[model samples]
Target: MKSQGGHFNKIIINRILATFLLMFVAIGIAMFLGIPNPETLLLIVLVMITSIFGMESGIVSIVMLVLYVMYFYSAEHSFLLYNRGTELAKVIVTALCSLICLLFCSLVIHKRLSKR
Candidate 1:
């Protein structure tokens, strides 16, 4: 039983790490490709992560992405984007979409698991 619990913990850790890795890799590729808007790519990645790893990992990924945007994408590296409404809008839209995706994926997963 103890070993089973430890194995489950390891799986959780791996999923969390994978979530971050996927986000970073997507961002890197978008930057390399000179994509004007990486937020769309990130949203798709978020949905995929949520569907595969479940809501907990998805929420962590969302928070990390939000912090990244707040720091790097905002004006003066701060969340005070008083003059940059577009950046603020992007963040808001992305966060809301990710949350919707997360809820949908969670429901689908719960239904499938319950059926089994």
Candidate 2:
């Protein structure tokens, strides 16, 4: 039983990493396409990912959120470049929206899984 649980955990970790990478790829595509609100697109994608992948999506969402914020801070010269309070506010809002979406997605996924 213990080994089974451990194996399950490992699978979840792998799934999270896979999902995170996919999210990054999608972000890259959005950036290239000049999406007016990549953050919103990201949140929508995250929710869909969670809905499809189940609970592991929460971890994926968190990793993506952190990396997204860091990219904004480090990119220096990009749409996400944040040099003022207003710019920073956009990041904050994106983070909050991601968190909310993750929570709702998790709950929905959990309920669905429990039914199985």
Candidate 3:
């Protein structure tokens, strides 16, 4: 049981590291490609991470993505800029959509695994 717990911790750490690495790589690629809408790419990355690493990682990814956009992409490069109603709305909507996608993916994965 002790060994099982250690193994589970190791797996969780690996997934978290992988999620962070993937997020940075996606951001780099978006910057390199000069994508007009980098959030779209980030959203795809969020979905992929959620599907592969499960909801915990998905939630982390969503928070990271939102913070990245709010800080790095904002005109003032600060999270406090959300005082603008439209900006706040966009972030809320994006986060909600990411959560919906994560839930849908988790349900599909659960159903598939339960069948086998």
Candidate 4:
């Protein structure tokens, strides 16, 4: 447990780290679900989370993304999945919706934190 909640820098750093960790977890889940180019999406997610959170999370997430990409591409078996046009469109739509929701939640949190 961290007791230095009053320190703004620490709070931001912690939030970033947590966001990155979440991004990696999300990428893993997506991989399990047969998503393709998980590394690229992971990088994007890391950027989004870092933008919503901070630099530390973005940097760390990118690091993990790089590692994953290396392993993913080097593996004899495919780490990414391929989909048809319709499926790709569907995935894009779902990703857009999810990003909207994430932004909405981030806004709410930002508002609440600003009020404090």
At residue 16, candidate 1 shows an lDDT of: 91
Name the candidate, 1 or 2, with the larger lDDT value: 1
With a 3 Å backbone cut-off (N, CA, C), the pairs that clash in candidate 3 are: none
Mind giving the per-residue lDDT tens digits that candidate 4 earns over 11-92? 8767866876787687778679877666556746765775677555555665566555544544353434423455445445
lDDT per residue as tens, model 1, 1-116 = 57888998999999999888888887778768877776677778888898899888899778866666665567786776635787788778777877887898899999999999
| Pairs clashing within candidate 2 | none
Question: Model 1: runs farther than 4 Å from truth?
Answer: none
Tens digits of per-residue lDDT for model 2 on 7-74?
Answer: 98988888787788878887888778987667767777787888877657666776676566546544
Clashing pairs in 4: none
Give the lowest summed-lDDT range of ten residues in model 1: 64-73
Each prediction's Cα RMSD?
Answer: 2.0, 3.3, 2.1, 7.8
The alpha-carbon lDDT assigned to residue 75 of candidate 4 equals: 33
Which ranges in model 3 have alpha carbons more than 4 Å from their true place? 82-84
Q: Which is the better candidate, 2 or 3, if ranked by lDDT?
A: 3
lDDT score for candidate 1 against the true structure: 0.79
Which candidate comes out best when scored by lDDT? 3
Which scores better on lDDT, 3 or 4? 3
lDDT score, candidate 1, position 46: 83
Error of 3 at 41 (Å): 0.4
**lDDT scores in order:** 0.79, 0.74, 0.81, 0.60
Candidate 2: TM-score? 0.76
* Per-residue lDDT of model 3, residues 2-110, tens digit only: 6988998999989988999999899889878988667789999999998899877887788888776666445576776755677777777777887788788888888
